[model samples]
Target: MLSEKSMELSRKIIILIYGRAFSFILSLIIPLVLTRLLVKDDYGSYQQLIMIYAIVQAILLFGMPQSLLYYFPRKEISDRSLLIKQTWSILAISGLLVITLFGITSQTMESIFPDHHLQPFIFLLGIYIGIMLSVMPLQNLLILEDKETTAMWSMICFTVIDIIILPSAAWYNPTTLGMVHGIILTSIIKFVIVIFYIYKNYLSKLETRESYYQEQLAYGIPVGLTAMIYVININIDKYMVGLFFSSSVFAVYYLGSLWAPMFGWITQSASQVVIPRMSKAHNNNDLLQIRELYANSVEKLAFIFLPATVLLALIAKPLILTLFTDNYEDTVPIFSIYLLLLPTYALNLGWILMASGQTKFLLRLAMFMSIINIILSYGFLTTLEGDNRLLGIPFATVAVTWISTIVVMYKSLNTLESTLSESYHWKKMVTIGAISALSAIPIIALLSLELENKIFLISSIVIYGITFLFTSFKFNILNDNEINLVKSFLPFKN
Candidate 1:
C-alpha cells in the first residue's frame, strides 16, 4: 500500500504527464505539418532559430522559474506571494534584456549565416523569447498552489492554440520568417493569459522586497548557469552541423538528432512532482526518505525509458520515414545514435542535487561537461570526413552525457552519505536493461523479414510491446501493486 504522501505524489505526476503528453503530441504535429508544407532549407532555418531561442532563454531566465519549485515549498504562505512577484519582475526585466541583446547580436548572426539572411528572424525571435520568459513560471506556480489540474488544462489549451496558429502561419507564408512570426504571436497570447491569471489569483497587492529578490537570485543564478551550460552542451552537435553544413544538410542532421519529447515529458513531469517533496525531506533532514525518493524516481523512469530506448532504436528507420517522410530517411542512423542518450534520461541526475541545494556542484559539473562536449564535437568533426563527420556529433554528445550522469550520481551519493549500491536500485535497473535487450531479439528477427515500411514498423512495435510486458511480469520486474495501479488507469479496467 502507498502512503498518503506517495499517493499524492503519484497523482501529481500523472496530471503533469497527461499535460505534457498532450503538448508533446501537438508539438509533433507542428513539425509534421511544416516539414511537408515547407522546404528542407526553410525548415532547417526554423530549427536553427529555435535552437537560438532555447540557448538564450535558458541563459537569460536564469532558472528563476525553477527556483519557485524549491523556494515556494519552503516559504511561508505570506511570503510566497512576494516571492512570486519578485520572480516575475526578474523574468520581465530579463525578457527586455533578451530583446536588447538580440538587437545587438542579430547583425553578427546574419554575418555568420549569410546564406540564411537570419537578421530579421533573429529580431522576431528576441521578442518571442522575451514574452515566454516572463510567463515561464505559470505552470510551476499552478503546481505549487495545488492547482495541478488547472495547470494541465492550461498547457493543453496553449499547445492546441500553438499547433493551430504556427502551422497556419507557415502554410500561409511558407518561409522561416513566417514561422517566427507565428511563434511570436503565440507567445504574446500566452504572455497575456499568464499575467492575467497570476494577477487575478495570486497578486492582489504589489509588494517589493530586496531581500527576497537577493535570496532568489542566490539560488536561481547557479541553477540558471548550470542549465545554460547544459543546454549548450546538449545542442553543441546541432550547432556544429549548422555552422559547417548547408541548411539542407543541417536539416537532415536535425531530423536525425531530434529527441522524442516523450523522454523529457516523463522525466520533467516526475521531477516537477518529486522536487518539492524531496525539498521537504531535505528540510526535515530526512536523508533516508530523500534516497528513497531519488531511487524510486529513477527506477520508475527506467521501467519506461529503458524499453523505450530499445524499441525506438529498433524502429528508427520506419519511424523516421513515417513521421517526416522518406525525405528524412537519412536521419535514421543519426536518430539511433541519439537514442543512446535515452538511458541517461532515466537517471534524473540534477533533481536530487537541486533538491539537496547542491547548486554550485551542478554548475561546476555543467561547465565541465560543456567543455568536454565542445572539444569532442570539434575533434570528431575535424577528424572524420563527409557524412561520417556529421555522424560524429551525436557520438560525442552520447559519450559526454553518460560521463556526466556517472559523475553526478557519484556526487549525489556522496551528498547523501551513502554508497552507490545503497543510493540506487542498480540490481533492478540491470534487470530492466536485460529485459529490454531480450525483447529486442524478436524485433531484430522481424526486421530481417524486410516487410513494407509501415506494416513492418507497426507489427514490430506491437510485438515488442507485448513481449516486453510479458517478460517484465514473468521476471517480477513489476510488483502486483504496480500492475493493479496500471490496470486502474485503463479505460476498460472494470
Candidate 2:
C-alpha cells in the first residue's frame, strides 16, 4: 500500500495530466485551423508577435510565480496570504511596465520588420502580456492550496475558450492583426476569472509584510534571470531563422520547430507536482527522499518520452506533410532534428537545483548555454548556404541543449550527495530505449508501402503503438507500483 503523501502526489499528477491532455488536444486544433485560414506570410507574422509576447512574458514574471512553489510549502498557514498578495502586486506592476515598453518600442519594431508591419499589433500584444502576467500565479496558488482539481478545471476552461475564439477571429478577418485581437479578448476573460478566484480564496483575510517582498525578490530575481536566458537559448534558432529568411520561409521553419504540445504537458505537469514535494523534502533535510523522488520522476518520464521520440522521428515526414500540407514538406527535416530534444525531456535536473536553492547556478548555466548556442548557430548559418543552412539552426540547438542537460544532471546529483549510478536509473532507461528502437523496425517497413498519406500515417502509428506497448510490458519496463497507479485511473475496477 502507498503512503498518504505518495497517494496525494499521484492524485495531483493524474488531475494535471487529464487537464493538460485536454488542453493539448484543443491547442492542436488552433494550428490546423489557422494554417488553412491565413496565408503563410500572415501566419508567420502572427507567430512572430506571439514569440515576442512569450519572451516578454517569461522575462517580466521574474520568477515570482515559480517562487510560490518553493516558498509556500515552507511558510506558516497564516503567512501564506501575504506572500500571495505581494507576488501579485509585483506581477501587476510588471504587467503595466510591459504595456508601456511595448508602446515605446512599437515604432522601433516596425522599422526592424518593415515587411511584416508588426507595429500595429505591438500594443495589443502588450495588453495581452500585462493581463496574462497578473494571473500567471493562479495555477501555482491552486496547486499549493491542495486544489489540484480546481487548477485542472481552470486550465481546461481557458483552453476551450482559446480554441473557440482564436480561430473564429482569424476566420472573420483573416489577418495577423485579427489574431492579436482575439488573443487579447481571451486574455481579458482569463484575467477576470483568475482575479476573482484569487480574491475569493486567498485575499479574504489578507495580511501584509514589507519584508516578505524582499525575501521573495531575492529568491525570484535569479530565477527570473535564468528563465530569460533559458528562453533565449531555446528560441535563438527561431530568431536566427526569422532574421535571415523571408516571412513565408520563417513560417515554414516555425512550423517545423513547433514541439508537440503533449511533450510539454507531460513534463510540466510532472515537474509541477514533483517540485513542491521536493521542496518539502529539502526543507526537512531528507536527502534520501529527494534522491528517490528525483530518480523516480526521471525514470517515469523516460518510460514515456524515450519511446515517443523514436516513434515521432519515424513518423516525422508523414506527420508534417499531413498537418501543414505539402507546402511545408521542407519542414520534415527540421522536425526530425527537433525530435532529438524529446529524450532530454525526461531529465528535469533544474527542478532539483531549484528545490535546493541553486538559483544562481542555474542562471550561470543558462548564460553559458545561451552563449554557446549563439556561437554555434552563427557558425552553422554562415558556414552553409541556401536553404540547407536552415537545418543548421536546429542542429546547433540540439547539440547545446544536450550539453546543458548533462552539466545540470551532474550538479543535481552532487547536491544530493549521490552519484549518477545511484541517482539515475541508467540501466532501466537503456533497456527502454533499446526496446523502443527495436519496436520501430515494423514502422520502417510500413513506411515503404505505397498508400495514401493519411492511411499510411494512421496505420504506421497504430502498428508502432501496439508493438511498443506490448514489448514494454513484456520486458517489465514499468514496475508493479507504477502499473498499479496507472490501472487505478482506469474507469473499470480490477
Against the unseen true structure, what C-alpha lDDT does each candidate score?
Answer: 0.84, 0.85
Instruction: Write one digit per residue (lDDT tens) for candidate 1, span 293-375.
Output: 88888888889889999899888888889899888888888989989888888884688789988899899988998999999
Full-model lDDT, candidate 1? 0.84
For model 2, the superposed segments whose C-alpha errors exceed 4 Å read 1-8, 107-116, 208-211, 260-262, 490-494
Candidate 2 C-alpha lDDT tens digits along 1-494: 45666755776787787888878877889999999999998999999988887778887998987899899999899888888788888999999999898877776777787554677888788989999998778888888887777788888899999999999999999999899999999999999998887788678888665546877888898998898887788789999988888899989988888874237778778778888889999999999999988887888788888888988888888888888899999999988898888888887458889998889999999999999999999999999988769999999989998999899888998899999899988998999999989999998888778678898889888998888888887887755666677676554221
TM per candidate comes to: 0.95, 0.95
Error of 1 at 373 (Å): 0.9
Q: Candidate 1 — which residues are off by over 4 angstroms?
A: 107-116, 205-211, 260-262, 487-494
In TM-score terms, candidate 1 sits at: 0.95
Error (Å) of candidate 2 at residue 350 is: 0.6
Alpha-carbon shift of residue 256 in model 2 (angstroms): 0.7
Lowest-sum lDDT 10-residue window in model 2: 485-494
